[model samples]
Target: MTLYLHLGAHKTATTLLQNVLKHNEAALEERGLARIKIQPRHLFWHLYRDGDRDAFKKRRRTLARKLQQYYKSWPNAVLSSETMFGTSDLHRVNCLYPRADTALRVLAQLTSGMNRKVIFYVRRQDNFIESSFINRLQTLATSLHLDHAQLLSDTTWCSFEHYLSSFTPSQLSWLHLIKRMEAHFGAENLIIRPFESIHRGNAAYAESFLAPMCATHDLELAPQVYENRSFSAKALEEFIRLAPKQGFANLRSLRLHLQDKYPNTSYPRPMLLSPEQRQEILQTLATENSILFEQYFSDVDRTDISYQPVGS
Candidate 1:
């Protein structure tokens, strides 16, 4: 069977895609696209890296059997998780484990004999950094005693800088993850696209994501789909502000309050890098992005990467 792994670099529409596939799982399976099931924190060794060393390996045997079952009956079997790309840990400064060696080794073991395809979505760095910060801040606002005022002081540039520093720009780029996966799956099996392009034509990202893979295999995806986009910044800010004033017990009530207030308007986005800063960063990335485009999208005249495709 062909194995399709939809990895997320966080802040992408990974959850929405999962929710849609979940909605149409049975029909898609009948059409030869069975999504491999994964436990929330287990598949990618998230809990294992968090110190519960016992959580990941045990599940691999069952997953391997599922992979075999797909090999026997299905034309195309799929797996998807944002955590697989070391994304869920973005909120924390220095996580227990930033590397994904254990997860990768386990995956390599489980999908041993299958033709593996890796698909990932890319978002612009500035927007990605902002979205990631807001999501993390919201998670903290609802759960922990965080310094929301200080975080809100001026802009989130410093916070974003701190996060980018942890991984460094080179590591933050998907080219890094793509190279790592290519080591295991090879460049021919990799399919990378921009998060924005996937959502083009007024289609939901989830709706557009699976259809193409099906077409490549001469199969079709289920027509029906679902979407669960992330929350807006206004709602997040309200959550932080009201969580303390109304107490954590009343956090839900406060959330309803903000949802009613803004309806659809997102809060103002954080300070993006200035033109000079952006130009400098792009200069640094020029060669690397060229190499990435050369390796992955050589035939296409353009690439999803922001640092202009080679020979713009």
Candidate 2:
């Protein structure tokens, strides 16, 4: 038995991956893999309920029962949730997965006695940060009660630099994540995939990536459906400009408000940058993420993906 955990660091085609897994659950099972749907609400309920001592004891018992059921239900499982990567508190993480070295380790323990593999997909920081800003706003609106415009202006609201600070330059960088995982779990146990290759509407990309991990199962390729929901650079800038004027106290409030008012907002679309802006962003990214552009991604293939605006 083997358990594969896909921890998304946000905006890395997580929804697409989850959708595909859900659609192919039956087929996956034939190959000895099960898709474990750990409801987000359940995870949150456990987290919050455990925060209170009395509630913690009760929930712990309940959670143990749930875990037993889950273990019995699936030998080889695929569990995914992006929130697993959001927190910076190691203690909180430890409380969730006590014996693991890192969050990845905790995942490994969940599937102990079973072969385990971790898969994480990351985008270029320059591109990721820009999308992250809007994502923060969306999160704020959905989770908190703050004004989006106000939150944008609040220095405390959302800052790309501050968010990125959670992980080391290497940890946040895809190349670094790949190298680190390779070192920790051996290349065979870790898989590093580029978001672009998958986005190219190529089924071969999916096959090539999943083949080794799932050789036991005869899987079928499904048509790829690109959501194409990210916001363009201009729209992102417009939102940024609108954010400060609205006066949000924090990111949570902004997201809550947005969710209340416009529940259908999607992730920002990838922005297309002008040549000058592209050059500027590339130069800035070079300062910390030089290796991402120079080594992780080949220059010949760089033109295929969207670019971020400079100085925004």
Candidate 3:
């Protein structure tokens, strides 16, 4: 049985993909694809359960026995979990400090002796960094009653370039990431593609994700409306400016009020990379991006990679 693993790099619409898979489980099964709903937390629990070594040992054996049985019966199974990529966004930023070899190695070990393929969707660096920050700010502000002003004040919370500085060299770019992943899972078995560029001719993004093992391409069983939408610049900025004063009750009430308040209002701020920022980021990653286009995606269309620089 082929094991298809969708190891997500977060903020790349992973939730939408997982939801589509869950909603269309029977359809996928009919097409000879089974979604493996094993909780990744179980693997993580055993990996880090240090307090009781004896207990951990017993738990590991039991889990392994169960997985072996599951693996036997499983047919073209697919597992999707963004956490498997080792991305962490504590306060709306990827403060993901991964011990590169260790984390991915654990994943490699779990799928050993099986025919496994990994599907990873990558985003433009600047766009990813900006979207990550915005998503983090919104999530933390609503859930933790965090003050935007204070959160911004923390020197650690800076631009995406600054964010990259904190990451290990291997975690800095998708090129490096793909390199590590290829090392662990072999280059031929890894399917790396631009998250933005791979939707050609597909009715929905989820269909593209399931393309590797699909016997049939009927996606009529799934919903195409993207539920988790991005906050417009105006809405995102206003939410940050106002989050400072909100208590638990106010946070929820104020957010609802804002939604009602600006039903059709245009944003005061731009949510994505400014043209200048995008140009600079491209320049910064030019070499790596070229390598990415050349290596893994050589046979595919290069339209997205051909984005024009700032001044024509």
> Model 3, residue 258: what's the lDDT?
62
Provide TM-scores for the models. Answer: 0.74, 0.61, 0.76
Instruction: Note the Cα lDDT for every prediction shown.
Output: 0.59, 0.52, 0.63
Error of 2 at 201 (Å): 1.0
State candidate 2's TM-score: 0.61
lDDT of 3 by residue, 260-283 (tens): 554323434344556776677677
lDDT string, candidate 1, 1-312, tens digits: 688888776767676677667777767776788887867765454444455455555566667887788767789888888766454445443422255555666677777778888787766554565577655654443423244445545355235566555544444455666777778777787787666655353244554577655642332232344333344556655555555554445544555566566433454434545566555555666676666666665253254335552244
Candidate 3, poorest ten consecutive residues by summed lDDT: 88-97
Please rank every candidate by TM-score, starting with the best. Answer: 3, 1, 2
TM-score for candidate 1, please give it. 0.74
60-101: candidate 2 lDDT, tens digit per residue: 456445545555776666667766544212211212112223
Model 1: per-residue Cα lDDT at residue 204: 41
